[model samples]
Target: MTAVRIEREIERKYDAAADFALPDLTGLPGALGEPEVQRLDATYFDTTDLRLAARGITLRRRTGGTDAGWHLKFPVGRGVKEEIRLPLGRAAKTVPKELAGLVRAYTRGRALRPIARIETTRTLRRLLDAQGNPLAEIADDAVTGQALDRTEPVAWHELEVELTAGEPGLLDLLDERVRAAGASPAGSGSKLLRLLDHR
Candidate 1:
């Protein structure tokens, strides 16, 4: 019953990477300005043995500001992931079946559960084009994460700039400005993976 697209034609890969950096476009209207750092607590889920990982997929239930819900982020391309959101529910410890079934191609009927918990303190800025269209979003994040098997905390800071629907060249233009702002690129390709790694 889910209207989600199958997209079987999409190719899958095991090892892919990209450089991520904070976007700098504070001068434009609708740009996100220095966001007060906020602590974000989230839990990531996957099949008992990571069936989703084998297929390059990620499913997580997160609670935070305006966007709290079940988020399923599918790998689309380098530096890009398509995020699907569902309404937040009462079940904080389990992945919603509605969202999980969408990953059947990857999970193959395997069970999914909590694999990690991630905590992030995010500082955000918004970038916009001259026409007031959102060109990109830049975020500076301080992350601390706890994996299921480990007790020690992992900490790091990263810059992330997500592009809006526009010319691809805009990313390059933004990247130039971001690098000039003294921010270096981070390793992961997707925000979901970065959060999951820490969780």
Candidate 2:
């Protein structure tokens, strides 16, 4: 079994217009880094009956980023989740045993299968303190999603600000600034759930 790593994710999402630009965040307590671009592709898995989705548990295999691998996220609270990650070791189209075992309570012996695929073109920037410590990361995403049903694919633009080494209050401060610039709070909790039209 490969090593399993755990992390806490605290982030917020926003829906953006087709022409939305990232607002000036330098006015806050940190310095903004140069923007980096990445193309990310991910496939989300769930039981046919959608048991995991109902419980807010997500398992996905993703590639094309610094953290490319298999990720299983469990909701802890609003805007908070505990993420378990494992390396991708030639197991395309297959969920790793370690990750599967973690969600067995919800899966209840049912099989997990690919339910949706999401492709993202991401422009990422980091918010750093005067000391050069990372405070948070802002992602501007152009996303396309399609369910396994093979129906029409949907696409949209969204923004995310995730805490790295920052305090929780930083989110609230950014929230006001981001909204003043015209982005609305995300109507959906996650990209997968939005893709599956759960919310």
Candidate 3:
């Protein structure tokens, strides 16, 4: 079975150290709640020359957390993208044809192969409004990335804040809190891009 998700996916990434943590967000429209931990493992695929990535499209098969599945994402605008999901079928590590078709125009008949794999241990927190309605999710992650072409693995820490239900201004408010916590914006385009570039 398959499911489609159309979210604005407005998010920002910041580099972190091992002992990184979040600052007080209670001052914003939504207050930060307790943290919940989830593990995410995603194997990214693309043609040898990375045609999909060249166009800001990313395809990955991931396991862990509530949204574990095959996710195909393409950029729609700044900080926004479209994601399509399909079940991790019975096949062993294979890309679904349906998803492949969607990106066929960009792929131009090239083969999709696993190029990089990233594993992240994430701590998540929900941002809630005055009435306890959820507004956003803030995630702090420790990451390990390995490129199939390279033998060494790269390790890093980062933070990501994703909006669930809230006005766009909430994102900017939360952004201020993160920046004040001694964290800086990410130096790469995406997790997969970071891995491929290092290798």
Assess every candidate by TM-score. 0.75, 0.96, 0.93
lDDT of 3 by residue, 1-199 (tens): 4555655577777787788768876667777788789999999989998998888789999999888888888888776777788877775467889888998898889999998999999999998888988798888989999988889999988888788888888888878888888788888658887777786
For lDDT, the strongest prediction is: 2
Output the better candidate (1/3) by lDDT: 3
lDDT of 2: 0.90
Query: In candidate 2, what are the lDDT values of residues 30-70, reduced to their tens digit?
Result: 89988999999999999998899888889999999789999
| Residue 157 accuracy (lDDT) in model 3 | 88
The residue pairs in collision within model 3 are none
| Model 2 steric clash pairs | none
- Give the Cα error of residue 25 in candidate 3, in Å: 1.1
lDDT of 1 by residue, 1-199 (tens): 4344222111111111134444445544454544555567778888778777555676777777556777787777666667777767778887777887788777777778887777777765555555666555555666667767667867666666666554566667666676675555654554445544554
Model 2 vs truth, CA RMSD: 1.3
Compare candidates 1 and 2 on lDDT and give the better one: 2
